[model samples]
Target chain A: MKARILVSFKDSVLDPQGQTVRNALHTLGYDAVQDVRQGKVFELDLSGISKAEAERLIPEIAGKVLANMVIEKYTWQILED
Target chain B: MKARILVSFKDSVLDPQGQTVRNALHTLGYDAVQDVRQGKVFELDLSGISKAEAERLIPEIAGKVLANMVIEKYTWQILED
Candidate 1:
């Protein structure tokens, strides 16, 4: 089994890194870019675990280790392949 | 229009950050986790641009600014919503 976890800052939080990227894009002539939010993606391989076990563990892992729940939110999907 | 850009290190690259996270997961008792890869995701909002223009510009933006082509690869998708 494989899983993907996306960890991103909540909309309410300020993202200076994102702002910096947006500014760089503007300077690079991509003026049409209105906003940019940067996030993290974690791809996990779980060949030893069952799908049900993976489903149950992924969110726990994402929250406890991969994300800072106070400022970031995480979503995850189990991969079929 | 909106688009998503995913930037990740190529398989040949050494991802110490990912290895660190995997170690953390192991410490947290997710022993089934075999491997982990970390990447970046950029969510972009482009209300003033047409879909065609966005398609043309996104890759240019991603390749030239968002990713280091020598070590990382990027993929993008246009969002309908």
Candidate 2:
């Protein structure tokens, strides 16, 4: 199975990278862009595991290693079988 | 409106960051993980633009700045009004 995890900053956190990108976009003439928030996506390929097991383990993996829970939020979904 | 851009390495490209993360996961006890790929997601907030306009502009922005077309691919969608 394959799974996808998305890790992003909490809404209250200031994202300097996002701000930098936003400014760059403006400089590049994309003035319609108001704000930008950057995040990460992790795609995992799994073997020797059933989909149910993967589903159970993904949250744990994401919490412990994929994201910093105090400042970032993570969401995940099974992508393929 | 809000738009999301997903930028990922092309399949043929080597991802050192993903490999490092995979190694870390294995060391951390997620042995079921076979491989990992990393990507970026950019969330954009736009004003004075219609969804249709955003849809039209996103591809241009992604291609020109958000992703390296030679070694990466990007997809985007409008998220909200």
By DockQ, the best candidate is: 1
Instruction: Look at candidate 1 and give me any clashing residue pairs.
Output: none
**Model 1 error, position B4 (Å):** 1.1
DockQ of 1: 0.89
lDDT (10s digit) by residue, model 2, range B3-76: 98999999999999999999999999899999999999999999998888888899999999999999999888
DockQ of each: 0.89, 0.87
Q: Write the per-residue lDDT of candidate 2 for residues A5-65, one digit (tens) a residue.
A: 9999999999999999999999999999999999999999999999889989999999999
Candidate 1 structure quality by residue, lDDT tens digits, B1-81:
789898999999999999999898889888999899999999998877778888899999999999999999998999774
Q: Which ten residues in a row have the lowest lDDT in candidate 1 chain A?
A: A46-55
TM-score of each: 0.96, 0.96
DockQ, prediction 2: 0.87
